[model samples]
Target: MTDKSETAQPSGLPYAMSAYLIWGFVPVYFKLLSHVSPVAVVAQRVLWSIPLLLVIMAFRKQLGEYAAIFRHKAHLRNLLASATLVAINWLIYIWAVSTDHILAASLGYYLNPLVNVLLGRLFLGERLRPLQMVAVAVAAIGVAILIGDALDTLWVSISLALSFGLYGLIRKITPVGSVPGLATETTLLAPLALGAVLYFAQVGGGGFGDDVTTSGLLILAGAVTAIPLLMFATAARRMSYTSLGFVQYTAPSIAFLLGVFVYGEPLSTTKLACFILIWASIAIFCADAIKSYRASKA
Candidate 1:
């Protein structure tokens, strides 16, 4: 089972921050490819990520470990599931960004930590505190308001939360190192990625090799996808899941600000209200986490 403590490891903090910061700004990267189809962008992400991940594995000398995951059926199964969830999450996120639904995408990530909390309670046998309970309730109310008023975009937020929350949970339990696990996941995904690339080429539908700028950006997708994921996996292994979840706030916070100001996505009054309530809930959740950590220390 994953650790129940809310105390983040000092070592994990850097990795968590690095991962979330990149994620927060990733919408910008995807937005640059807005002319590309979401499926093609994700396919490029998978195909390009493979070699970068492999090189990292070679440098880390974790190639043996990466291969070992496939030999271990149980671990392989878990990684396959995780790969699927993360792929879904990536596809949805890119689609949302390309479609100018970044505000909704930001909201989804804002709710992700809470989803992690609930997943921890249900699957990892973590107990919730009074404040944590209140936090959950408030977040739910905020979502309810979103559902009532902005039903169209609610799916984007909710899907991102559930898929990513599940992916993190699986990675935490998979008993594989960060670089190896992600390498393995990308490897598992490569065949379909290859197929997608071929299909896009045949259909003349993809952005790759279209120009110096577009092709270069598409190639960089590998690094963009792998680096933060490796960092996140490292952080997840070092810290408590809930603490890691809280650290996730940084990404969405940045993304939310970008959505409103940089991206200029419209924020309806209802969405603004939901953001306020969700922020309040996050404050409550952080307080509860601090209290629990202190109590544990005592």
Candidate 2:
């Protein structure tokens, strides 16, 4: 059974902030590994994280949690789906950052929450507020304008939004906690990651460990992936979903800044207009959510 603790709520603020901060700066991290293959980076991140995650799980004595997850067939299915979506999201993101397509990456993440809103309306039978309705519509307009110039990048944005939105939905329904859930997901995918590492190594492409810098970054990737997840889970347990929605924007906002200034990616007027509209949309949506949360709390 999942333990519910009132005490768990208080310690979550730092973790939540840390998670968002780390996530916001991820463009910088991947930029370091730009020369490394994105697929290989992701594969190693998944593969190398297994042992570290396991050690953490053992230390936490959450093996019972891990065991219980596998015992529930429905939860197993959810984890698998979540894993697939997250892996795809990660791969696409790494590629986008490494290839100087950070602008497209920013669009994808910016659109992800809106995608979740649509999914909630369609699948969860949630009703949208008036502001939310306008927000999404405006965001759609923004997307259309951006797509006019670079239609080819639309798939990247769409895929990132869809996969991540779906992953969030599935994760919300999962019974397992963060550490164990991530451990199990990574564990399930570990063998494939290991095989790929070995195959690429044999072919002289060399695995992450072949180079000191690459290996170090790969290990860091595991820590990076696991830590935010743990923090997000902690925050989720304490905070309202609406607050989470608001905090989620911090990541992409930082990514946008990094893309514009650090990566030296050109931002055309059309793309700028899209981002402005999207930001306005997010502001509207968050205002509505805040009002709703206050009303419910009161």
Candidate 3:
């Protein structure tokens, strides 16, 4: 059985912050690889992550745990589904960053926590507090505004939110450790990733060996992919979901700053309006969470 007490510890805050900070800065990394195809980048990310994860598993002496997980058909299926979702998320994010749609990608992540709350209510029979409901409704309004004003790129945000939300939901219910589970997901994806790399290489389009700098960056994707996830898993184990949800905003917030200040994505009036509503919704959500947490403590 999962230990509920583990989620309430304050010590996990640093891990959570570290994970979000890394995630927030990820667009910069992807931007450096903008010359490469999104599919190729994602393939490289998946392929490279496997060895790094394996090494971590060996160091942690969890290789046996990983082997044992495969024995369960259900766990394998869940991981396969999660692998698909995460792959889609990665591809979309890479494409968005590469195509100068970082703002849209950032909006997607901003919407993800609300999506998670909605998912919890729908699938887990969790009750949403009144503030939570209001937060969701406000976020919905923001999304609607985006749809009305910038329908062309709205799908990017929506797809990213849905894919990642579903991925988290699956992983939440799956009875596997985060590292092992990620290893399994990458393992399932490795064949397709390898094929993609080979195809790109054959076509003289692979970024892997085209230059020393690009090759190194592509390899670094492995650490970039693995480290934050491990930290997130650790944080999830050590902190309440409410606190984690609050911290999750740090990533999108940084991405938003990067999108506006660094990448120079336009902040048109409509987009600005949408962001305002979303931020308000997040504020409301956080306030409610804090209130409830305090009440529980008292």
Candidate 4:
């Protein structure tokens, strides 16, 4: 079971396919949980997810990773902050999907790359190339085109994207592995989640069982959240960044299709134009990434 063969790339097809397909289908799951409040849903997701993640980590004897993390004050602080950012990101996404704002959610993810670019320049002190700057500018225009009176949801999308992008940046700099990092982050927030669940129950929110069906859907959110992350971690370790980044878009594309066709969300001419512009930005971004990657190899 040890993957020590240098010549053998781990079978990336399973990891990539599972992550993409599962992420693509996320809107359906959130739609099913529409009856539940977004806060409640997120609480349940985080609280319920901890046991599953912990059990897996325990079985793999990775409790030591958790111990190691707590010992490092710098890593611990960053993990807590990153955890909060991810929680906000998750809550906003669920709210958007539940309220039939799937296109907006898709737009957030589409803009995520540009947000990452900005963060790289601002925090990491990395410089962007001219084309990279143009790509980000085009993406901003695309986002503006999509913003038509849905100011609240649009802000939510932008905030979530930027927050998660920065969270990712911090996570990369933190001296922790994916599993341990996620576990610690989720662990830190588990108490708040548990408290919310209890408070909601007392307020007749039905907590975990407001409706049996909704409850089931909420539990399923854990698997939904965990699976893609696992796959992404696997894919990141096994494949090139270029390949992984390209595949990452599949989720949002699937979401766009689900939003426009299946969910019957409006794809106005303006929104369509926005989508096109964003896609063009992605094309430019990818070109730069590929060039950079190749240059490094050379």
Best by lDDT: 1
Please write out the lDDT profile of model 1 over residues 33-52, one tens digit for every residue: 99998888889999889888
Q: Model 1, stretches more than 4 Å misplaced?
A: 1-10
Better of 1 and 3 by TM-score: 1
Q: How are the candidates ranked when ordered by lDDT, highest leading? A: 1, 3, 2, 4
Instruction: Give the alpha-carbon lDDT of every model.
Output: 0.89, 0.80, 0.87, 0.76
- Candidate 2: how large is its RMSD? 2.1
lDDT of 4 by residue, 154-183 (tens): 786687678767776766566565566777
Candidate 2 per-residue lDDT over residues 94-201, each given as its tens digit: 998889988888888788878877877887677888988999999999989977787887788889888877876676657677778888788777777787777778
* Residue pairs whose backbone atoms clash in candidate 2: none
- Model 3 Cα displacement at 276 (Å)? 0.2
Candidate 2 TM-score versus the reference? 0.92
TM-score per model over all chains: 0.95, 0.92, 0.94, 0.86
* lDDT assessment of candidate 3: 0.87
C-alpha lDDT of residue 208 in model 4:
72
For TM-score, candidate 2 versus 3, the one ahead is 3
